[model samples]
Target: MNRPTTLREAIEAADSILIGAGAGLSAADGDHHSGPVFDARFADFRDQRGITDAYSGGFYPFPTSEERWAFWSRMISLLRYEAGPGQVYADLLGLVSERDYFIITTNVDHRFQTSGFDKEHLFYTQGDYGLLQCSVPCHDATYDNEKWVRQAVASQEGMRIPSELIPQCPRCGEEMTTNLRVDARFVQDAGWAAAAGRYEDFLERTCVDRVLYLELGVGMNTPSIIKFPFWRRVYDNPEATYACVALDASAPAEIADRSLLIRGDIAEALASARG
Candidate 1:
């Protein structure tokens, strides 16, 4: 495999590329760290000990389902619609949008799409912060979450957040909420279904072609979705060339000969890649 010193070289060697993004991408792009409430709550959780962001938080400690919904809805409200300007993400998208590419991200914040990426070209592996779905997995429908999130902020009462942010289903009117893919029961409403179909279709169309895989700011904590499977795919495909922009500069040992491992910040590396 020939190593690329510039963006042109990277594109010349491969037919198309598939991008995988993670939290670090948004962080590097200057989005605020979760939220002010996040810092306070994280400290409090640690102060109590033995308690973490519960995986099955919808069913976690709370006298009633309403309280549980309150905690989770507040969390969802903070992370999705609310974030910093997306100039970094938009710039990155401009560089790649011209090429035959598809993006998959674990970021629930709609940054990629908000930055002008076509909605059909992206697959948000994690549920979107901007959308709400039925908590009971009733049917495939989604609603914009902005109104409720705004309501939550407007009705703010101290650090606990406003109760109105907690969403309820429109159909059954029972506990409707963000479609964040945190566990086994996450619902994929209409938009999710369409996005997922595009993702699968992208993979299908590209299956017969040689692909360039670009991984940005992904790490091992969620190895299966972002990091490790990427390494495995590149390793298994002899025609593929891999590149990653990560804080840790390490290549899959098995594919080190065919990969470009850049140890740097994502926004900086994106600049380098574009140049």
Candidate 2:
């Protein structure tokens, strides 16, 4: 979908637009799966394992879970919490911040907020890598991971992290785990709860407006969050327009009745939106 000729027509008629973004969107914004950082950082992992890409380096499979956590802790610090803020995320914020919009994303990188989306309007459905939660889920609290992560970086030696930040459950005094919600045990920290409330409020209020459900960079991996719900809403609301921009994007077979499928890059699509 090159810049749409009817761009103004689309937004002018749209009472509201809910932006659902994912890793794919970031890819277009200049953050791909692998780039210079991964190239250099995983040189060690590659030499030892005869592989390529930090993604593969991460899944190299160390002997112990402790070793795995150590590797991941550093990775998390670099990827999720401290990316130093890039241009792509900033441009994305510029693209949508002015509009009547709210974002729900599963990406744990925290780029949306880091680049300046209002924290109140953005909901990170997955737990952020910048936070730590109980592995056994002994309690509801999610401690600030930034401090603990920095400690790991400072104390690590010979490929092992210090025992101090072994990520134990603060409530039950068990091993602390990544705040990612991979399973039922994943803890929803206080921030997560508040974000969820805001997300619910957005849906509750926007459902009444003439919404333009903008689904960007979302794929089948987790269809429920972006694809299914948005499509359902579009189907229910005659005034709604389901505009999805993705690489080789296609909606559910049944959604053919009311959907505008734009198959292309997000930057190009946003340029179309800007038109």
* Number of the top lDDT candidate: 2
Query: Please, what are the lDDT tens digits per residue for candidate 1 over residues 158-216?
Result: 33444545677777877775677767668776777788898888877876567878888
TM-score (all chains, Cα) for each model: 0.81, 0.87
Residues 95-178, model 2: lDDT tens digits: 667778888897778788778789998888877778877788878887777877777877776567766657777568888877
Off by over 4 Å in 1: 5-8, 34-78, 159-166
- The lDDT values for all models are 0.70, 0.72
Clash numbers, per candidate = 2, 4
Q: Which ten residues in a row are the worst by lDDT in model 1? A: 49-58
Looking at model 2, the pairs that clash are: 3-272, 167-176, 168-176, 169-174
Candidate 2: how large is its RMSD?
3.1
